[model samples]
Target chain A: MSGTDKILLVDDEADFVSALSERIAHRGLAVDVADNGLKALDLAGQNAYDAVILDLAMPEMDGIETLKRLLDLNPDLQVILLTGRATLQQGVEAMKLGAMDVLEKPARLDLLLDKIRKAQANRVLLVEKRNEEKIRKIVDNKAW
Target chain B: MPWSPDPRWRDSDLAFFGAVTAGATHELNNVFSIIEQTAGLLEDWCADPEADVPAGCDKILNVTERIARQVQRGTELVRRLNGFAHSADEPCCNQEMNDLLENLLALMERFAAQRRVRLVFEPAGAPVTLTTRPFILEQAVFLAVSAALAGTAAQGIVTVQLTGGGAGVEITITGAPALPEAELPAAVGAWLGPPLWNLEGRVRTAARAGKYAIVLTIPKISEEVP
Candidate 1:
């Protein structure tokens, strides 16, 4: 498994989550499933997933709240939101909250796969930048 | 008292109209999402090897059927919504009771289903056509239904029965209680003003078999809009 290609699929619909994860797995990517936001947070904390595919509406924690918590736990994590009933205002609000993107439901699998690959690349870049900053700081401190 | 426009009532009515449209659009969005996912699945199955995917074509066929069904449902909803929007285009127009209520009820199906209430429409006789302010009259009836729903038990039935006689149409709503006399003023406030009163010849409430009933008598519009 390419470490950066792992994804967490969070949605209340069990069948939809199963079908979608199967598609993602068929594409040669590792996927974890979470039926609700609470379970999603658990999976995120336990594994280093490259991104999350989250549904906007749920029973306990809605997409916006879950998105907030997910980013708080991993500032660099990429999150793509899915919504069956999305409005322009909701999309704008989600973007302002640092989501990688908002995709209306029944998103094309190929397009979603493409987005996942892009998110994986962006995460790798962020990690490399952070590592470079840390190394430079260490060298400067040592010299001082 | 002379007729005067009530801004608050207008605002609330507009808000109700907005909610109705929003509900229809949300349903369409879900339909589109299902179609997208199904088509994507079909493509995935088709892309794989024919030998390994004997059922691929069959699955695509099934998905296409499902998509067609969704499109039909979405089209019907859009058509009903279009009918409702046009109901307001003119101040006064001729309306058939059955046709008007069917479209309005289609728009209201979600609200009723959400509350687990079964809506029943009973036409006593032949189609009754009346000339009136179609939108206002429909709004008044819809609000009465909403009011009755407030007192209705979940899974209970709300019946809108239509009858015609002597140059007028009588709509009797039974199942849930009518808005109390004290609250009727606010519920029908602006819509029941002088101009509307002329359209609704009579309004009253009565109890039938321990169930509340609200009756609205609609008079035929005398003059056509120029």
Candidate 2:
């Protein structure tokens, strides 16, 4: 709804998260970063975000678990999994578990932004579809 | 299963190597990501059509270029690590000793810098090519450097030299005062002791005045079956 989208970045590497946060901010997006998966979930609970960029190999709770928890809290949440261990099996598993997409490590900033935009677009479509369903159900009840 | 028949030892060794290699590569990836982000920021700044050109853009570009070079160095270190991992399967092979030493130095650069120890490498007359398991040789060198650093004071210099001789290739590590006897961990000594003693080559250490020097001679080929 706002001009700039809100993005939450979660990774164990401090330097990487810091640098990426700065770069995303430069691209006119409001960015919040967490050092690990637990901190990421805490942040997700506190704020509403347009999308979350998560790292797969983290200490406390891994990306898959974190995504599950975040989605349970808000089913509409969009998640992008970023991992250095880009195994085919893991990628497919993430997508099956409701991740918007899986990206490899060292992904270009522009490419990440594009994925985020698509995720956001998908979120909008889902909401619109739900509203349409609600209207159709109301019309059916009135006719009966 | 008998103690000797169990596969645990091999599994543990594989796990240890895998963890170390993965951790090192992950750290290197983080370094590259930071450099990329910094360069992207500069490019964005330069591309701002409405904004005025900032002062000292040239200096920023120079610094970013330096960071890029460091990233390349990190990538090379990872490549060396990959090579080392593959070398485990090859018991013996022909290798350029100088290149191996350089790669080892690069691999340990961050560790040395963190400890404030200077690593100096002085190669012999010409590049010495040898047939050996370079990974094992690298492990020996790493252990020797760690020992030297532990013995040396902060900001001390650890010098590594390679020389060819009648026996084979001699790798020497020289540093400040000898490491304290109590500091030598038994496991490390055990891992290094047999190879240093049983191999045709010899590993010798001597206390000269106050400083210490460790010399390791590795033969061009193993005496074991081909």
Q: Encode model 2's per-residue lDDT on B1-226: one tens digit a residue.
A: 1101112222344543554476567657666766777677667767887544367678676657757776786777679787667756765667788888877766665445435678898887787888776666776676666666556665788899999843379888887753563333332344456445433456767665666677888887755335
Clashing pairs in 1: none
Where does the lowest 10-residue lDDT sum fall in candidate 2 chain B?
B1-10
lDDT of 1 by residue, B100-156 (tens): 887887787666654567888887577777788888777767766665665566768
Who wins the lDDT comparison? 1
Candidate 1 residue-wise lDDT at B63 = 58
In model 2, pairs of residues that clash are none
C-alpha DockQ for predicted model 2: 0.16
State how far residue B91 of model 2 sits from its true place (Å): 2.1
Lowest lDDT sum, 10 consecutive residues, model 1 chain A, at A13-22
Model 2 misplacement above 4 A: A1-4, A130-144, B1-28, B50-76, B79-226
Model 1 chain B: weakest 10-residue lDDT segment is: B1-10
Interface RMSD of each: 4.0, 6.6
lDDT of 2 by residue, A1-144 (tens): 332278899987665676678778877789999977778888999987888999887754678889888888878889999877656888888888889899887789989999988877877777788899999999999996
